[model samples]
Target: MAISGPSPFLRYGVRIANEAHTSLDEAAETLGLLGYAVVDSGLDADQLEALRARFNAIHAANHASTDVERLRAIGEVDLLRCPLADDPLFLALASNPRILELCERLMGAGFILNQQNGIVNPAGAKTYSQSAYHRDLPYQHFVSTRPLAINALFCLDPFTLDNGATFVIPASHKQEAFPSDPVIAAQAKQIAAPAGSFLVLDCMVYHCGGTNRSAADRRAVNHVYTIAMMRQQIDLPAYLGDDFSTDPKIRQLLGFNHPTARSVEEFISQRKAK
Candidate 1:
């Protein structure tokens, strides 16, 4: 049978449009329409190398010995908990004005860093758990009128097809429901971009890691930002403590501004005290 609509991935020119885009508004608009957009992170080769070294140091400290161990402790290897504490670069990149701007456009003024993790897909690492096609906010059953979360992937190494570049379903974020059929789920396109590329994506988009078939490792830093009203995936405030709470922008993004009232009465009382 003849195809009805153009392939979702094809419609976006995702595979072909591998050039770096620098405009924040253009990137935001592309993401709004296609569920994701890849743009230059403005990091040069030296910066990329430094970031990679920092990530490796943190990963080594965690003692991810084997592929099985790394896979088993993906959260640990990925530095899921308090990654900002692991490296200062994490804080700088996650809070970059360009990144914050896109997030603010999607999630309003106050956006919380829901999660930041290191993604290292090494070759011959069998039994890939991250390869499962899924959404970041998997537990949420309902859709929000506005995007509840924005995810940015900071590429530490070039994301090539063979090294398991991320696979995403274009326009899937707009769907009120998840794809049920296996065939429908298989249509996701792999996003290939060079090192120093930052991919911004809607949290609701259907996406997943592809298997690492190449000899080299595929590395990226994943940062997820959510509406400030929602609780962060990790208690960034507790980990960061009161010291880094001085900056207004960082404080707000870290959810320090979120009220700690026990109830409506207490909330009012606390507000009155302020």
Candidate 2:
């Protein structure tokens, strides 16, 4: 069939899908129409100050970048073997409602938090450290089907033009990858939202966090929600474990069961983690 749509992934489901106009679901649906499967909001005013406090602690403790942690943990494998889900700061980041709503829209009825991490884009950080365009989901090991996934990065500091912000190729999720052109790379759009802005993105879309050249650090928290079928990078069971109720939403997210009756897929398999 000659499709008259942007792409299958871009297909925005039905309207009034989330109790009509008053819900965040409607906003998510609208974002889907643009081939972006996620939506993010400004940080809730109530938690902004607390977030700032936590950001400083994370920076001082040298836990801002995954690559850094991954390297250090590998060297001292015993000390860092624990899954990242148990981190209290991470838990706080995962509970953001704006993130919850968008994840639900893309991953279906019971999307749950899978990962929490941070990045402090300091001024004059190495260029490659910011990363080149890539898809978070395309490279992950998946089973018979692709589970839905969404990712959000909340800018703790204002992402301005001078300081680098994330750059995304709109509608690129359907492309699976981007074209190779020096000109396009130079002209690609940068998403520079102010502090407190949430730059949510579809997991499969091609994007890259930009380099920071400003006089200060540009911080953000990176969190991901995956459909129940997929193995979270950090096991849910190990993270929240027994501290909370086991509702289906919480259970599936805790890696107790697959939500929506889906299958499990992992890059590196382990019987106990899930």
Candidate 3:
């Protein structure tokens, strides 16, 4: 008799159910095993509506100035560093207690906010920028027992198979080797969550956005969180400077006042004190 591997489909379903029921610890365990987790109805109705509206307004304003040729080629627009950055609602959503707890489970405390970008995938786009299966972080030869980074994709609109829902290769994060095209194609699973759902993923997972073939734009925002020891994709502290809120959680998420020695002398002093 031989032992068999877990079924990706069944495993993911169980994980999603776990997250939906607020069994965060179980969901985190599943995420560690499968590389992804889906939390249904993570946001309230009013919160979802507000996020959608704010995203729409900002997208329309910025897209008006975008080069048509670039838009045509890309078929998508990512509003990098969302204008609603200052909005406590967006900040709260990004660092939602549940999400933070899940992240902390894998990455430990002092997770830094790495990115927040609103994505709009228009229908019938000739070339979807993120259609290729790839990892979020730059390729490295090594892997970590603990996750270095994680993502939270908040769905502002229905994520349908035909509307650019994300595709992921289950358990790919555990593999130290880069996935070949054939491997990715064979194992990829397209995920469709309802509006207001939150999809969390390990950053090392092989994943991609599906092509949009629907009539309307598929909207979502991505919030990336990483271990505080990792370098931020964007210099958030520099950008925000003194303008950001004084909220402790917000400050922590933004990587402000993270415990660190500024120099060798400081490190020596702190060590002596300890």
Candidate 4:
């Protein structure tokens, strides 16, 4: 028996490339099947400039202090953890409605922001923590029927082959363990996206940041949104203080309503009150 395209005996269906679908539909579908998708953020020039400026300023401040040596010791460099605590713009970007829509589709209602960090692939750097391939929920070797978390990484600079675009293994989220080196070498794909675009991913996807071979740094802001039951990377509600936002959605997204109880009585009371 000759196989013309895919074998009819195969149990799985193959998606046709270049199908006619709306942008949101394409993003949702790709995120499910490929473990990642790229979507235009639609930020204007001024907005893009503002985000880039903020990231640069924060990056400089972090690098100027003892934090640089401390981070470098742990193989982490050029990272600004929880930049939203420093600027309102970062908070706004974290809660962008378009991003929330996709998060809602994958994570269902009431997903909370797990972490937001500013990432920089320094020009001509040999290695950094992010350069190593790992899952957003690192050290886990399990697959979920649905996504437990998703990363919405906003590009502040255009991602290119010369400037360290992200490398991802498509549909790797479905596997229980990291693929062998040969499989990774054969299947890893570099994602190129313009500034003011997002490279969204299933948190389980195996991916890494590429080394920047270009003359300039590549900057991005990464937001991880997870199901509300998961602990946040940072205690955002506590870190941001009680008065971060009056909007109910923003409050909930920041984990304000999901605080831990101090005692059994408090836990029962809190549940009853809810």
Model 2, residue 263: what's the lDDT? 39
lDDT of 2 at 240: 54
User: TM-score for model 3?
Assistant: 0.81
Candidate 3 stretches greater than 4 Å from native: 1-22, 65-76, 84-86, 259-274
Q: Which digits, one per residue and each the tens of the lDDT, describe model 2 over residues 83-168?
A: 23434545556666666766665666756666666666667765544456776675743322233677777777777777778887
| Per-residue accuracy of model 1 over 1-274 as CA lDDT, tens digit each | 1123444444543555432244776777778778898867777788889988888887776665446465466444444445577788888888877888888887888678888888778776653556777788885656666789998988888888888888898878888677767745576789998899887888889888888888877788898899877777777777778787598878887787875677899899878887
In Å, residue 151's CA in model 4 sits off its true spot by 0.7
- Tens-place lDDT per residue, model 4, 1-274, is 1224544454447565434246766798889999999988878999999998988888788788756677888766777899989999998999888899989988899999999988889899877668999999999999999999999999999999988899999999999999999999899999999999999999999999998998898899999999999999989988888987898989999999898888999999999999
Report the lDDT of model 2 for residue 172.
60
Q: Which consecutive 10 residues in model 2 have the weakest lDDT in total?
A: 75-84
Q: Model 1 — which ten-residue stretch has the worst lDDT?
A: 1-10
Better of 1 and 2 by TM-score: 1
Once fitted onto the true fold, the runs of candidate 4 whose alpha carbons sit more than 4 angstroms away are 1-21, 65-67
* Pairs of residues at least 3 apart in sequence or in different chains that clash in candidate 3: none
Alpha carbon lDDT at 82, candidate 2: 21
Sort the predicted structures by TM-score, highest score first. 4, 1, 3, 2
Q: Rate the local accuracy (lDDT) of all candidates.
A: 0.77, 0.59, 0.77, 0.89
**RMSD per prediction, one decimal?**
7.1, 8.5, 6.3, 5.2
Candidate 1 vs candidate 4, TM-score winner: 4
Q: For candidate 3, lDDT tens digit of each residue in 147-251?
A: 898988888898899898999999888878887879877988998988987888988888888889988888888888998887776677777775586887788
